[model samples]
Target chain A: MRPDTPKVLFGIAGQLIMQIMPEVRTPIAGQTLTLSAALLSMVAQEFDRAASRLVEENRSVRTLLAASRDTVSEQALRSRIDAETADMHEHDFHVSALQAVNDRLRSLLIDVHAAVETTPGEAAAGLNERIWDELKESTRRRHLASGLA
Target chain B: MEPELAKYLTSKIPGSTGMAISNVFRIPGGASRETWMFDAAWEENGESRSEAFILRKDPPASLLASQRELEYAFYRAFEDSGVPVPRMRWIENGSEALGAPFFIMERILGCDSNTTRIQDAEYAPVRDAIARRMYEIMAEIHDFDWKGTAIEEVLAPPAPGECWKRELDHWEQVINENELSPQPIARAAIRWLRANPPPPPDRVTVVHADYRVGNFLYTVKGIHGVVDWEMAHLGDPLEDLAWSFMEAWEWTRDGRKGGIIWAEDAIRIYEEASGTKVNREALHWWDVFGSVKGQAIWLTGARSFQDGKTAELMMPFTSYWLINFQDEIMLRAMGRGA
Candidate 1:
């Protein structure tokens, strides 16, 4: 925390690419070092925003799930939607905990999306569009700069 | 490894004595296999013989669970068939010889296979010619007759209508087995692919599952060898065409396929060479399917590392760098992207 994580990580990545990679004798070793540095840079980028992304995504999927409760025709799926959206508070702020919640919600979102695609109505079609919007937003949340750049 | 390899060569090459291996080095970027290059010298029938060879050995766990024998058969099928490929020498199925199933082939020299190499200003003069030849060679690969070849022995040809289902089923199973977290986008893509399947090819042909630029060996002269046949199988030929057009292999972020040729030119060249009309709607279906397959590969690599089955840093790097990028590409392919 002293140097800040991104600064430290950028320094390490710089050293790996500029210093360590050239000294590696084998092509495989050099490639490994290069990829390690790239992974570190990506990890650093995620470190600062992982929790925020997960929380935001969990909230977005939860809202979508709640909106789809009426459109979902199956009893079992509706119960799942009710159970998952009942307590929407982020009680645990840990990245792992947030990610666990995000996974559960997104998995449910897939089922909801499949159901909505089949249940014929304007509401289902509208909700399906909203799901696609959320899915696109999800990619934006996890996007990283190209490593080759 | 050198002594063991020397022993194996001596045993295989009859009357070869004092077999020696040198300059052995592992090549980079082969995430699915341990590819090593080395030179060997031996005396056969009192004649001095030296050759450069490539060894493809199976890793304990890889991004792909391909059969090495099948890969060998695919490579063997293309030998001297107008499609340029390295000559296969020997294939060992048992792990007793090399700790894993492995195959050896004559290494093509003076060729560059790096993805970014052609983007340099130096290659500008021959880049178009090379790109044209790339598509021409792909047409040859698809037009190849695999009947009565080693390929037929190892691979079962899918029914014309079953091609799309077979590939989608295989990759979806891969994702189901290896995904570390939930993948909503990939799931949606799979559902869409199954609901709207691509029409079957005119006939079943060999689909070079990874036919992009990086997989081939090229020089200023022209394309020489098309390598990486680990995923070769019988499927719709358009699968390869759409795969060649995937954005994941677009190294320069250009709209060009493989950062070499425009999609239109590549499609024209492929169509002319194979005498098959290009179907835009069906190709779009495979383009979206390509992203799903790409995501499955990255996810498999991530799970391999997370489970401690491999320590290859490329595995995690691909997971971080390509998984989300692939989803974005899938979105664009499906016309749902911003």
Candidate 2:
């Protein structure tokens, strides 16, 4: 916390690439060092925003689930929608806690999205479009500027 | 490891004595295997001999569980053909000598396989020639007849109609087994693929599943050796073409496939060499399928690392760098990208 996690990570990554990598004798070892540096750089980026991103995504997906409650034809899926969106507030703010909740919410979102695709109605179509928008947004939230692709 | 390799080579090459292995070092970018390069020297009938060789050994766990023998057979199939490949030397499947199943081949020296190497200005002069030859070699691969050869014996030919289904099923199963979290985009792509299957190819041909720029050995002259045949199989030929056109391998992010040639020119070269008319719709379907398959691979690597099956940093590196990026590529391929 004193030096800031990102600052420390970036410093180490720079050393690994600029100093350590060139000294590595074996090609595979050099590659490992390079990848370790890259991973550290990416982890630094993720560390600064992990909690906020997960929380924002969780809230967004919950809203979609709540809106799709009626559009989903399956009773089981509807029940899941109601259960997941009941509180709509994250009580636990730990990154792991937030990530666990995000996983469940996204899993439920997939089922709801799949169901609405075949439901055959104007309501389903509108919700389907919204779900696609959220899916696109999910990528934007996870996109790393340093990503290789 | 060097001593073990020397002993193995002694046994494989009869009448050889004082076998020695030097320059033993692993190379980067073989995420699916541990690839090492070295020089082997020995005396046979009082004559000293030396050669550069490549050793591909199985890691504890990797992105895919490919069979070494199948890969070896595929390489053997292309021997003496127009498709340039390294000469196979020996294969040891028992793991008794190398600590893992491994195959040795003659190394194609003085050629680079780095994806970004071609993007440099120095390579600009021969970029077009290399790109044209790359697709031409791909055409030669598809035109090759595998009947009664090692490829046919090792791999079962999928019916033309079942090619898309077979591949989609395999990759979807890979996702089901390896995904750490929900993949709604990939799942949606899978559903669309199932609902609208591409019309079967005119005939099943060899599909180099990972045929991309990074997989080949190239130089200012041209591509010399096309490596990485672990995923080779009998399938629709368009699968290889579309996969070559995927955005993930666009190293420059400049829309040039493989950072060398445009899709239009690549397609035209492939058509001229193989004499098969391009089917735009079917190729589009395979392009989308390629992204899902790419996502499945990255997910497998992530799960492998998460499950403690591998300590290789590339696994996690690939997961972080490619998983979400592949999702965006898939969305664009399916006409849903913003």
Model 1 scores a TM of 0.98
Where is model 1 chain B poorest over a 10-residue stretch in terms of lDDT?
Answer: B248-257
TM-score of 2: 0.98
- Cα lDDT of model 2 overall? 0.93
Error of 2 at A98 (Å): 1.3
For candidate 2, lDDT tens digit of each residue in B236-275? 9999999999999998888999888899999999999999
Of candidate 2 chain A, the 10-residue stretch with the lowest lDDT total is A21-30
What local lDDT does model 1 show for residue B167? 95
lDDT top scorer: 2
lDDT of 2 by residue, A35-143 (tens): 8889999999899999999999999999999999988879999899999999999999999999999989999988898899999989999999999999999999999
Per-residue lDDT tens digits of candidate 1, residues B1-338?
99989989999998899899999999998878999999999988989999999999989878898888889999999998989999999999899999988999999999999999998888999999999999999999999999999999988899999999999999999999999898988999999999999888998999989999999999999999999999999999999999999998887787888999899999999999999998999999999999999999999999999999998888899889889989999999989997
Native contacts present in candidate 1, fraction: 0.83
